[model samples]
Target: MVGNPDEPHCVSHLHPETAMDQIIPFDPERMIWGSAPALIYLEIAVRVGVIWIWTIVLLRWVGGRSISQMSVVEFLLVIALGSAVGDPMFQADVPLLYGMLTILLVVLADKAVDHAFRYWTTAKRLVDGRPTEILREGHLSHAGLDKKGIGPTEVMEMLRRAGVRNLGQVEYAYMEPSGTVSTFLYDQPRPGLTIVPPLELRRLPAPDALSGACCTSCGLVRATADGTCAECGATEVTRAERLESREISSA
Candidate 1:
């Protein structure tokens, strides 16, 4: 056969044995050896077990960081899961069918757990924990702080992120199951409040003089300078301003 000196032997397929070698070589060393069934299963079990423990520990440790840590865990999960799958794919004696089966089993178990979380309250608590009240009525919940392993500084940070400059402005603050701080403000905010931001306002006293104030104790929309709140009889109030509803509507 005539061929270029620089190119491979293109006519090698013309030889009987050459054609057979190109398709399925007689060299069993490259693709021979059946793995033990028990060993293969054991390997799969170990891989899945390690991955499971890794996932649990990672979430639990970083969960205190809340929203910031969620993205980190999710991003790392992709790399970890890919590594888990690659081992079974490249192992010479491991069967592709077995690898796929293990993956399916994991998926099914995950789905089952999700179902339990949705339907069972106890299961949800075990997995996601309960919403702990960290602050209420301008007072810190000591038990909540201890249970969540958080201090005043962390609480302030969470509040700032939520656009709250003052803790007195918040009625209730909860550490939610999803590792987020949820804040609820009072109905009427006090005016010229003595309490400032970053500090936990322990005791809230009734207002003596109201100049542009809202009754946080009651739903008082209007602020009066001379008298107590007409709606809730609350003397203590915060600064009150009319919310322009040009862009949105309540009813």
Candidate 2:
């Protein structure tokens, strides 16, 4: 009662309201603004200013990828910020409908642009930009650099950072849609590669109808069977016959 209304203890409730009947007389209209109209206009202007400033700051900090890959929390933050400041931008009322409509229109325009980019290659190139191919088959293509607006010096810098001193080591290099560079390195190749794995080397049982067992490595399991592993490419018939004879004697 003795302190100013603008003071922390009076303005903000740090603790529960006292049980004592304290009569504090103050006029809300006089304290905040002289009139309701002035208060309303001030509130609206502040809201709009806050929204505009917050949007610019967030966009500058987060970058364009924020719009491309919006998470649930980020999306909600964008919505809440816009909603909180909408009234001040468009109307003097706290519940601003015009500001909301403007926001909705902007969102719709963004969606339309996104859709157009996806459907048309030209549009995609204009909005999202096309991926640049830096390297092809151990060679660096200058055309790719031209398209990406970069020079060989910059490309070399990137390569050095990637621990690659020469272009001969690269198999493929491409720029990603998110402005990230992807590279593939060349490696040695194996010979005589087949579609199926070599299972002939491992020994297994055979039907009783065959006269002799075959080499596990060559797939000569029995004389009557295919007489080939078909997988390993090994063809040793003597080992198969010897193993089969021993099994027959044991039986």
Q: Against the unseen true structure, what C-alpha lDDT does each candidate score?
A: 0.56, 0.46
Best by lDDT: 1
Flag clash pairs in model 1.
Answer: 188-215, 188-216, 189-238, 190-237, 190-238, 190-239, 191-237, 191-238, 191-239, 207-236
Q: What range of 10 consecutive residues in model 1 has the weakest lDDT sum?
A: 242-251
lDDT of 2 at 125: 51
Q: Return the TM-score for candidate 2, rounded to 2 decimals.
A: 0.35
lDDT of 1 by residue, 114-156 (tens): 6877789787565556688987654456568778877656766
The estimated TM-scores of all candidates read: 0.53, 0.35
What does candidate 2's lDDT look like per residue over 1-251, in tens digits? 38786766554546666533232334344322324454655565566546544654554344333454453224535675566455445433323343454455445545665677668768655434456787665445656755665554555556555655334455677754454567786663111111121223334445334334333331223334444544334444322222122322342
- Measured by C-alpha RMSD in angstroms, how accurate is candidate 1? 12.9
Task: Tally clashes: model 2.
Answer: 6
Candidate with top TM-score is 1
